[model samples]
Target chain A: MQWEIVIGLETHVQLSTRSKIFSGASIAFGAEPNTQACEIDVALPGVLPVLNARAVEKAVRFGLAVDATVNRRSVFARKNYFYPDLPKGYQISQYEIPIVERGSLEIVLGERSKTVRLTRAHLEEDAGKSLHEDFHGMSGIDLNRAGTPLLEIVSEPDLRSAAEAVAYGKTLHALVRWLDICDGNMQEGSFRMDANVSVRPAGTTDFGTRCEIKNLNSFRFLERAIEYEARRQIDVLEEGGTIRQETRLYDPQRDETRTMRSKEDAHDYRYFPDPDLLPLEIGADSLHSIAQSMPELPGAMRNRFVATFGLTPYDASLLTTSREFAHYYESACAGLSGTTPKLVANWMTGALAARLNESGCDITQSKVAPEQLRALIGRVADGTLSGAMAREVFEALWAGEGEVDAIIERRGLRQISDSSELDRLTDQVLAQNAAQVADYRAGKAKAFNALVGQVMKVSKGKANPQQVSEILRRKLALPGYFLPGA
Target chain B: MALAIDDVRRVAQLARLRIEDAQAAPMLAELNTILHLIGEMQAVDTSGVEPMSHPRDVAQRLRADEITEPDRRAALLALAPRAEAGLYLVPKVIE
Candidate 1:
């Protein structure tokens, strides 16, 4: 029997706040082990936890962006657990009360769009890091990351395949970055995902045992880990073995997952409201104020690019994926109004993107300014330069800090659109290639291509090929040459 | 509302505790007491009430899109239990 994979993702997004979630300690990464640890972070006796107002607002912004219901009041609960990284013994997280709930994100996979609904987005303080070395035979702990605020966004098990999970991840990545809530840096562990995967028979209603894969930071790893886990689970069931529900770690080097521990139900955490802090309450006025300040998200921006600029959906999506690229493209089309949008989009997607990728720089860091890019496109539009010469001019402008007009003048890359000049070159070519010209007179239609090549060679590719061809045919029919259909 | 013995052992294993078979009975009894107390929370009837994820009503703060500093390799390695040169020291598994 065929099996279906049911996958859910719980992503921990480290809020982009400067200070710790519940304390005034610096929330900087790669700091001294115990230096950033405050009394609240270390869970010192009699120390109270104060919520960061900014962190709450960030969660609210996410709720509004996802069109989720924001809780006017929620309670903080202490999740009782004992680990070396968790100094508090009980991690202060939301249990029954969470900030945002019942939201959905639309992800485009291949040609179809899928809506991945969010279970909830809860706020919790992060634990410290545990260092285990092979030779030391001992473990060490760093408390710098302790008390760091994390917004754990949990998704429903609506994803079917690894590709769908990856598409959902990318959509979330873009949303958080666009909203400026989280930095969404996978390398920094600020944005991380824990995926729960299980397989049930294709037509069966009963769900199979699930495994949770932890600490998948990159999208490639997320896809690979899920694919590996789903297959592993299916193989286990096919072999007449019962699959165990457990938490697993993805060994990226080996490209396999191993059991870390058994999965926990909510009753296991012994969750209770923390007596140290009061329940969080927000007014409608505050939510409205934050909603007003949100910038145009990626989805709306992509729609605008297609509708306003008349660009293809693919081109618009590609350009609007990065905010900097979209801003640069818009700035390039500031002065020109008509069809400049399509022209600018082409240059950005083609030459500009190629150069940026080759040099390993972002659009903002590239030396080519929007105005200069517009100038190069203007040359192509007005026919002062052929499409071929405009590319060379773009390269010159990109490599050097020279204006488009200056590069055009210095390289003498102007197109020869003048019919008179082209005619002279064509006639000179006819005189020089006498054998080919006689062959053309003797009704060899292919001989005319050789004459056009000679004109281009003489003009050093500066002559317009179209104008040269037109002038060549006109000159060939002027006298005793038998120019058929000329 | 008390937790069953199987539930207590499951929770212990989830938390990575190596509880012996003999210790399971008493631990199960203690866990039942705690679960009974926590069960009081369910009695509050939070049917339509939203769950609180954080404390305050403020949004998340942001930083400028700029690389501020280099990775402090030496300082970070100092926290590791074992380190040699710039890399963390681990056991050699391969021959």
Candidate 2:
């Protein structure tokens, strides 16, 4: 029987503000545990939570980027629950009316794109960390992370497959980084995802029961957890069992999802408006300022790469994965003479990307300057260097060697593109390998490539393969040439 | 809605309060009296009235994003019943 997977993601993006959402405490990660927790963070008596303006600004910036409705007035609510990590016994969040609503993110699946509709993006305070190990038989509570502002971006159940869900997640990660709102660091728990996964029989509109998978921090885990949970649900149904609507935890080590233990009333978070904080109101002036401060979002920049550089959507999408990467490509494309943007893209995504990965260097830390890359691409385009020779020059450039022209001149790696030089070389190769030439004249197509390889060997690997093939094709078909079989 | 003795016991348990069996009936009656007052208030026609989250009409004041708090870990840890290695120790809690 065929089954379809349905997934929706709730991503918590920790805003990059310096201070916590409610208090004046530092929200920097990796601090000594509980050192950053202030009196307000610990929920001392007579302390009130004052909303952070920069957090609101960043949230509105995101809302504007996604063309969502920025609610002018939104209220903070107290999500009441009991946990040692939650010093207040409640989490301050936005309910009923969030700060941003009805946003959509366009996720590219292979060649086609799908718009994942966002239910809402709410502002909330993150809970503290609970370290379960290494404290005898007791738990350790570090309230340092408490009250850090988070924008909980919730999406509708639009993803159909694990791959699609991963694509959506990666797209969202790139976007938050592009906006400079979140650092998009999964290891530090700056951005975390909770996936709602379920499966139904193919061609059914009735939604199946979904189990919420909590805290899948990595995209790989998100995909794997969803796939495993879907299979588990399908198995249960096939065995005449029903899936329970509850929260589950994904164990990455075991690669399985297990139901989280909760008291019967634990899920009932009796949310009410937080009486301490009044309604948060964003004025028109503030919204305008935030809109003006908005950066060129990833989607817009991707489209511009396509429209301006004539790149394929796929290439554009890959290039615009990060703002810095797109900037690097543009800087290289600037004042390009003989080469096209497509060629620059090939070199960037092909050679440069591989080298960067191998060396564990970011695009910003690239040793080869953008202008140097443009020059190298120009040599390839003008036939001054074959692809192989250009790669050699690229390596030299990457190694802090001199400019493209000087490297080519010093190494004598220029392609033998001159017609006469290639002709003489091809003639020398053809005469030396008359048996292969005879094979070629006898309609053996494989012999042609062997002949070109011989010419390249004669040219010391500098012969342009395209020119060698052309010269060899013309010479092999000559009427006056002797054909051994004929 | 009126509260039953079982409902009182459940609420007390949720709040982590200890109440004897003899106290349950009086607690239910008192909770029901408060609920009756709230129910009477709910019966009033306030259809056009906006749900007031706070009594005052003032919006929340925004705070500038700056770290004004200093490291008081030592002083704060002194207040906890059991703290070691800069972390507050509690009863073992598992997910």
Candidate 3:
């Protein structure tokens, strides 16, 4: 029987707040061990945890971007657990009521778009990192990440397949980065996801028991883990075995999900409202101000790029992957005299994107400035440089060579568009290849192309291909062509 | 209301508290008395009354995002049972 895969994601977005959520300690990553942990972070006695204004504002901003309801008042609950990294016996999180609720995000897969419903986005403090290696048999606890602000975004099980799950994750990742709320750096552990996957008979409305896969940081891992988990569940059910509703960890090395320690199953979080902190209240004024502060969301900007710049939806989506990239494209397209946005986009998503991926650099770190790219594209449009020659100029520009015009002049890479020059080259090509010329006259169509190739070759790739083709067609079509070179 | 010896033992285990067999009886009796009092209070709940999260009727005050704490790795690590390389070392926890 065919089975349908169902998936839900819980993404933890590390806010870009300068300080810890509850304390004044710096939350900067890669700090020396426990230096960033302060009294409140380490759960010192008599210390009170205070909320961060910036963190709340960011959560509200996210809610607005997704058109979600921003709760006016939310409570902080204590999730009691024991771990070496958790200095506090309990984690402060929003349980019953979160700051943002009932939002939806749109994810695009190929030509189709689907909306993934978001259950809630809550405010919580991140636990410290546990370094398992080194120090003999003992584990080292680094509290530098402790108390860092996180917005745990929980989504409904609306994703049907692993591909949909990946698309949803990528869309959410782009959204967070576009809003400037989270850096969305998966390698840095700033953003991570937990996927709940299950499989049931196709066309069945009833849901299947799902096993939670914890801590999939990268998109590739998310896809692979969900696919493997879904297959595992389907196999178990087909063999008349029950799937245990337990938390499992994805072993990317083995490409499988394994059961985590049963300690996770025995977790009685004993969630209760923390008496130490009062309910978090967001006023109407603050909400309105945060809404105003939110930048144009990715979806809106993508639509604008399609309508305003006359770009394809896919091209627009690619360009708007990040706010910086969209800005770069806009800057390059501004005041463009002859080039179309489509041409600029092609170079960006095709050539420039490849270069950026090769060097592991982002658009902001590109050596070729927007103005330089615009100049290069303009040369191609104005017939000053052929498409191939323009690419060479682009490579030189990327390599920190001189300006576009200077490079073209220095390398003699300009397209020979002069009619006289192109005519002379075409005559020389026809005269040198009498056998091919006679074949063209005798009704062989391909020989005509061979003649044009010779013209381009004689011009050392500087001749305008379109002009050479036109001249060759005109001369070869006429009867009785004498061999001048002979 | 009453409590079993097993319940008391399980609670102690969950709390990570070491309770001897002799103390289990007294702890169970004391916990049963507290539960009896709580059972009496549960009978008097008004349906319209909202559940109170905190005793005080005040909203939380938010602090501005700023780094005012200095690095105190040395002082803090000195208080731990064991520390090395500016990290608190404890029994290895795999899960």
Report the number of the highest-TM-score candidate. 2
**Overall lDDT per candidate, in order of appearance:** 0.82, 0.90, 0.90
**Superior candidate under DockQ, 1 versus 3:** 3
Q: Tens digit of lDDT per residue, candidate 3, span A1-486?
A: 999998999999999999999999998888789999998888878999989999999999899999899999899999988898898889999999889999899887877788999999999999999999978899999999999999999999999999999999999999998888999989999999999888889999998988889999999999999989998898899999998888899999999999984444568887999888899999988987887787888899888987887877778888989999999999999986333788999999999999999999999999899999999988988899988899899999999997999999999998999999888888777778998988877789899888888888999999999888888888876766654343
List fnat, each candidate: 0.03, 0.88, 0.87
**Winner of 1 and 3 under lDDT:** 3
Could you estimate the TM-score for every candidate? 0.80, 0.96, 0.92
Instruction: Estimate how well candidate 1 is docked, as a DockQ score.
Output: 0.11
- Model 3, residue A370: what's the lDDT? 91
- In model 2 chain A, the worst 10-residue window by lDDT is A261-270
RMSD to native, candidate 2 = 1.8
* CAPRI-style class, candidate 2: high
Stretches of candidate 3 off by over 4 Å are: A134-136, A262-264, A337-339, A437-445, A479-486, B1-10, B18-48
Please tell me which model should have the higher DockQ, number 1 or number 2. 2
Ranking by lDDT: 3, 2, 1
Question: Model 3: number of clashes?
Answer: 0
Higher-ranked by lDDT: 1 or 2: 2
The C-alpha stretches of model 1 lying farther than 4 A from their native spots are A1-5, A109-112, A134-136, A199-208, A234-242, A263-267, A426-456, A466-486, B1-95
Off by over 4 Å in 2: A262-266, A337-339, A484-486, B1-5
Give DockQ per model, in order: 0.11, 0.85, 0.79
